[model samples]
Target chain A: MNRYIKLVNFEISRFIKLYFVLIAITVISQVTGTIMISSQYVNSASEAIYQHGVSIEQFITERGLMSMFQVTASLWFLGPIALCIAALIFYTFFIWYRDWFAKNTFIYRLLMLPTARINIYLAKATSIFLLVLGLVALQLFLIPLLSTILKWIVPVDLRLDMSVTELIDSFFYLQIILPQSFVEFLIYYGIGFMVVFIVFTAILFERSFRLKGILLGGVYGILSIAIFTMPFFIFIDYLYPIELLAVETVLGLIVAAMSIWVSHYLLTKKVMV
Target chain B: MIEIKEITKKFGRKKVLNGVSFTAEKGEITCIIGVNGVGKTTILNAIMNLTPVNSGQILINGEKIHKGSYENVTFIPDAMTMLPQMTISQAMEFMQDFYNTWNQKRASEILGFFKLKESDRISELSKGNKAKVNLLLGLAMDVDFILMDEPFSGIDIFSREQIAEVFTSHLIEDRGVIITTHEIGDIEHLIDKVVLLDQGVVLKEFNSEEMRETEGKSVVDVMREVFKA
Candidate 1:
């Protein structure tokens, strides 16, 4: 347990700087987006009412408030979020490859560490999990903060004033990230966690077998995806919706366990630096 | 004692190591001397399980090597193993975190001996300083066997001299060491046994003193006869 925690902390420290940069980018871009849209709304409203003698209600009806939904829709707002997600996904693979490709062959040291090689694998997987969770939590926290900025600029009559949950339900991607119920959250993120592990295992396979392992890893990944969705195709006619979800969750867990086992085998027996 | 028996390793279609076997006893230094690409580093990596072998077994103290058993052995590769972003202190802490056999006091002593500051970042260090840090990480570990691959390769003469001093120092006293190097002049006298390798095969394994007294031939003399290079 101590060794595992040490590995986790070590992995976290390696990417902490970049993680902070990701957060900074998200916050800055999102804030700038909110301010820009809010200023535009206010400017257009003032121009029409003062210059052309239009009513405030008409301006309010025409241009919506700087709500979370509105903030999320703009390219300035969504662009950074998209970049953050893409970067994190890229990092999932880069974290493992960096050790081998970086100067000085850090993989040799990591592989030779006196712990079970599985600890290294688990630690890396856990770090990615923590990073994703941290970023999500930050996004959740920022919604309210960015909402406050919107409220300050836009009048209450013009503002929509929707809660964070309502804004999440408004968008498909947001709903996927911020599920309404605990079970939904688990089902969604559980499959995500499984994907991270599968990718990690695939990387290990490639590292172990080189070019041949690349094809093998791709096959293994496809198999993992197929296995997770098997319950849907195989039991949809026989099972209820609740039962189907339960079965899918169980399958996801199974795939995660299998990926971990295969990763351990590759790390211990086949992986070379 | 450490024993490697019939270890074979292949990278793609090329056989890097084939039917290699050797031993390094306690309180002795075993050196694998060969030309570049002769499987010298691969042999050490196999012993540490850094690179998986295709066949055969490695025994430490008469038991097959297993997970969590690497504490008894340490490998100082030619490349820097610690993350380049890490400070010397953090790297030490990292070693301490993973290896139960890491000796903090010995690590501190080695730091002082090498004149390496704990705050020094690995990325900013000179090549010689980086090599010293690598040696420090290995020697500080309280292990029975130390496997080093080309520790003296591509360094200034001063750095080579400093690393050579480590062999005679109490840091490695009473510990079995297996080292591989193409440049053998630096450690020729310090090594107890020399294992001559050529293209993944062990050409000769003999005690240094016995080879010199009985055969009246130094390691270089044998290398010339073995490879005719």
Candidate 2:
């Protein structure tokens, strides 16, 4: 267990540089985005009330108060969020492949470690989990700060003050990041976790068998997704909503277990350095 | 004792190791000698379980090798295994973090002996120095057996001499070692045992000094006699 944590830290340290860059990109792009979007909204409001001879009430009724939702809706805002999502997705595969294909084969050292090989797999998974959580946490902290920036630019009458939760509720992706409840958080992230393992097992399949394994790995991934969602299609009309959630959770755990088992077997019996 | 019993391995359809077997007892330096691509590194990788075997078993101290086997054995592959961004000290810290077998005293000694700076990043080191660091990491471990694959390959003559000098010193004393190298002349006098391999099979295994005494043939002569035939 101690080794597991150390391995996780080691894995984190390897990518921490690129991770910092990712964080910096998010901060720069999003903050810049908030300032620009708010200034534009205020400029438009000014144009309506002062230049066009419209009443303040008319302008406010016409355009509504500038909330964080509008800022979040723009390409300036959504672009970085999309970029972060894409970056995290790309890292899921890069985390594994980087060790194998680096200047020196770090996978050799990892494989030859004195602890269970599963620790290596689990550590990499845990690192990815922590990275996703870290970015979410950053966004959580950034939301209030960004709202403050919006308030500084847009006048009180021209803007609507929103709590972080209210802001998140209005945006589709933020709700996914910061789920409304603990159970929802587990359900969403649990499926994400299983997909990460499925892909890991697929990678192991490829590592074990090379060319033929690539085909085998793709089939395995598709098959895992098929198994996880089978209950949804088969029992869609038969089960209650709560019962279906329970069934889906159980099925997801089973798929994750199977992936971990296959990964263990390959690492022990079939994988080559 | 480390035993390789009739181990066979195949890559796709080509046989890499065919019923190749040998044993190395503690406190002896055993050299696996063969021309390039004759399953030398494959055998070492098999013993360490870095790669799987098609059939047969490898035993350490009369038990099959497993995950825990790494605590008592270390494999120093030809290339550097430490990440390039890490300084030499950071790499040492990594090893010390993972393995209970790590010996800091010996590690420091080797660091000094090889003239490697603790602050030098692994990526910046010369090939010879990188190889030294690779060897240093393995040798600093207090394991019972050490497997090295072509440690001397691609090294400068002076560096190779320095590494050969290490074998003769007390650093590797009383430990089982299985080293594979095609360049036999460098450590010919240092190794105590020899396993001559060709075409994925062991042609001969003998005590080097005994062969030198009774058959009056050096390692090269024995290799010439076995491989040529």
Candidate 3:
């Protein structure tokens, strides 16, 4: 456990130190966008409702503005996807250049380290997870700052009675706000992302084969999803009264889990260089 | 002590290793000499559990080493290219954190012996110095068996001599070492047993003294005749 902690800490610290400038740029963009949008909403609230024939209170309640703020504060799903892309691009270039520079270095040497392979995998995954989470936290911090700034510009009547502490509490809850039915869905999504990379890396390790593993894994992943859901789709046409969202969510989770599990098994057991 | 029993590895139709077997006793150096594509490095990979074998098993100190038992082994390959962005000290710190058997004091001594400064980034070091660092890390591990695949392939003569001394004086004591290399002149005096391989088969297994006395030939000469090189 101590070794695992040290390994994860090492990875996280290295990533933050190496990419602080990029992270700072992302945060600055997010903060600027959040402040601009919130100020616009505050300024146009009265006009939007009375002149535009839109009931502000009803629209806000129905659309769940509070929940939307929380979700947007966490950068929604798009934030994680963006972060993943950035990480993938950075690591891809970094790994490629490093391997090219040191042609004779084998992956077997890394496997010989006196720690569990699973721990190494987990450390890297955790670094990605925490980096995304840290960016979300930064976005959340800007909400209160934006709110305070808007209050000075606009009258007090237009501003909602939301405090930074309240906003933080809501944001914290939003972090785990998924329903029990969707919990597995989110978990599987995260695992599926991890597996895609694991398979890609395993293939790379096999012979330093370029992008074949990733490409193959992607094809396999899509095939697996199709195979898993095609039967359900066929059956669902007959059982027209079924709860489609619930059934789809459950099936998606199962398929994602199976794909990730298979990917990891193949990576650990069959990978060679 | 390390023992490899009847190991076979096949990639589809091509047999990389075919029912090969050997053993290394404690406090002795076992050298594996083979032509290119003869599975010398494959054997090391199999023993280290870096690659799975199609058949047979590997044991260290009479205990089986396999997928679930990977922690009991250590291996140093021919050449390593670490993250070029890392300094020597940073890499050492990473090794110290990851390996339970890492000896910081010995690692420091070796760094000093090689005249490698802590602040030097891996990219700044020459290929020979990089190879020396790889050797030093392998030696610093308190493992029962150290498997090195072509340890001196890209190193300079002076660094090779320094590494050879480190291997003879401090690395091989109450622990088994298996080195695969073509450069026999640097390590011939240190090796106790020699295993000759050709095309995935063991052609000969002889003790160093026995080969010298009976054949009146050095290991290099024997290899030259065996491979017809």
TM-scores of the candidates are 0.97, 0.97, 0.74
lDDT of 2 by residue, A59-110 (tens): 8888888988887787877777788789888989988888888889988999
Task: List each candidate's DockQ score.
Answer: 0.81, 0.87, 0.37
Give the DockQ of candidate 1: 0.81
Error of 1 at A252 (Å): 0.4
TM-score of model 1 (first chain only): 0.97
Q: Quick one: best lDDT, which candidate?
A: 2
Best model per TM-score? 2
Candidate 1 Cα lDDT to native: 0.89
- Candidate 1 residue-wise lDDT, B84-170, digit = tens: 888999999888888889999999999999999999999999999999999999999898889888889888999899999999989
Instruction: Chain B TM-score per candidate, please.
Output: 0.96, 0.98, 0.90
Residue A98, candidate 3: how far off, in angstroms? Answer: 7.6
Residue A125 shift from truth in candidate 2, angstroms = 0.7
Ranked by DockQ from best down, the candidates are 2, 1, 3
**For each model, chain A TM-score?**
0.97, 0.95, 0.55
Which candidate model has the greater DockQ, 1 or 3?
1
